[model samples]
Target: MGEVRLYMFQTGTLKCKYHDIYLNQGEGRDWEIPVPFYVVDHPRGLIVIDGGTPVECATDPHGHWGATADFFVPVLDEKDGCVAQMQAAGLDTSRVTHVVLSHLHLDHVGAVGRFPGARHVVQRTEMDYARSPDWFQVGAYIQSDINRAGVDWFFLEDSWGDFYDLLGDGTITLIRSPGHTVGHQSILVKTAHQNVLLAVDAADTLDHWEEKALPGALHSAVDAVRSVRKLRAVQENTGALVVAGHDPEQWAAMKRAPAYY
Candidate 1:
């Protein structure tokens, strides 16, 4: 199989509590962590894992994200947006064939509007949860960002069980890892050299993996624990390199776009 290259992009950074991310007990220092999105250059077509915060959030922070924007206060320049990052890496954003949304959280799916031509993949449960009036996390889901035109939205059924092979080629696999949100998922990319698990909020840091700790912000602690266990099992089975969602230290050390893994 031809290797599918994975490129990392930082759409922006937002300030959140360390305790909220890692389930750590403390006063919780403010964490300015990278909001990451990935591009998979597969042989079939380009796939974007998560969109990160859109440039709109930068321009009209309060307008797009409401009070949460003010609370987290995303630090982003216009150039730090997903489209700019893809262009910077010399990839055409319009050519992005498919967009796999891990969940509909503001931080993850903010750039969903940027790829209008792409078919967006999300779990059925997540779409339902996003559209609901329930205020679970407060400012977690923004309807305007998701309910829009030109989005060829595709939802995976609950019957898919634990995982759905996105391409059916072993290039990109979506693992059903819930708890952070109702239908949260993670991506596993198989390259020629190694398998990489984009544990995208499933485990926010190595600490979560090491300690098997549920995130402080969780929908169901039981499901969170099960998701973590799934990640561990995948790691043990395939020896995949784990990339956490909001790990400050890990983000600092990763090779950013213009470089690929």
Candidate 2:
């Protein structure tokens, strides 16, 4: 079996209209969320899930996404930049062999260019949306780095049954849980100690998963709800540790860098 480690790369608070959607009521209170990226050190190589926001977001927040940017997300400094944090942990960016993206949102796919050698695994539907987005419906958040870097992109179309043995021992498996985006997915890592499920954006916080809540601003409200239920079912069946997309409590509990998992 292979060993796995999870690192919390970023932690920040965001104020978005969608927060109420998850709450199922319009609280009008700014939603304080935590943004984190996980690193899984399997037998194969170092694998990163969901690249956090780039450093540029903190510098030129308005320039990239304009006014709406601040409305949805507030960038955190320490955990925002992946390169800086990785270097501190003594891990060279070049060592990353694979990158699993939950979706192509600006907050998630910001630092994709850092690891040029790494193969990017994403859902084909998400890639299509990033290429040609319906601005009126969903916000445009695709970064130019994705196109600039000649990345080896692996697009999953139908299901995630193919990546059953990521760790070569049935430990780490990528679960395709579509909801937030048409191609949104989650990671199921079964470690020696426990089985952990990284529900990246599939459920923003534990509140969403526990209460079956749907964020207000989503591509499809019904689909989002369905995804949450699917994740819950997995949690029930496997008894895995369910980590939400953005939960401040979970992020705070995790060890940063040098100290992994």
Candidate 3:
């Protein structure tokens, strides 16, 4: 079996609904959420999870994100992108063989075009949901990110279990945990010492996961709870370290890119 080293990168940050919003109903505070993308140095090839906010979003946030841009306001810089971050970490962008997205939301797929050589993976149901999203969810789905030409896409349409082993080695697995989005998923990486669950939007913060609370942003509350529970079970069963998608606390404690897990 191949050992894996996972590195975390900060692509950007998002100012979004505060924790109180999900816990209560008052005019909640604003939370600054860190937007992270992970690079897995797998024995077979380099793999990246979730592209962060594009550099272009910094110049024209409204144009790229529309109305919701004000809600989860992105803080991006020119050098904040998948390729740029990888390059900064001393990795060759051209060597990225797989790019797996937990979902197709703008923030999660913004820099998808950066990895030209990688097969961009997503759930088929997510693509379909993005194409014909409900009125309320329209602001989160950007067509440009999904319809780019020349970008290779590998859709996970069918799987035997709750997850699909991307490389068939059990080293990396994509688990179906729909909640934040209809087809939202999470990544499970088996390292030498422990299992790491990249619970993307399935659980935005550790607080949400620990409390079994739903975030302000979600497609289905019922499904969202179910998804978080699944992740919790995985963590409990495997004694894995669960990584939240935008948890400031967790991000603060993490070792930045170049220093890996």
On residues 1-261, what C-alpha lDDT tens digit does candidate 1 reach at each position? 456789989987888776778675557677678899999988777898877987887788899888887667788888888888888889877778998999988888855867767889999999998888377565888788788777899999999787888888777889899988899999889876678999998888777777656677788888878898898899889889999988889889998888888
TM-score, one value per model: 0.95, 0.87, 0.93
Clashing pairs in 2: 21-216
Best candidate according to lDDT: 1
Give the residue spans of candidate 2 off by over 4 A. 17-24, 137-140, 143-145, 159-168
Between candidates 2 and 3, the one scoring higher on TM-score is 3
Residue-wise C-alpha lDDT for candidate 3, range 1-261, written one tens digit per residue = 566888889878888767522655336677777889888888778998987786678788889888888787889887887787788889877778998989998888865767677898989899899989999889888888788888898888845557899988888889999978999989999877678899988888887788646687878888889888898888898888899888888889988889888
lDDT of each: 0.84, 0.70, 0.83
lDDT of 2 by residue, 25-101 (tens): 65666656666777777656778877677566666767756765757665666545777777777776777898888
Candidate 3 residue runs with Cα over 4 Å from true position: 1-3, 19-26, 158-160
Error of 3 at 85 (Å): 1.0
Q: Report the Cα lDDT for residue 237, model 2.
A: 85
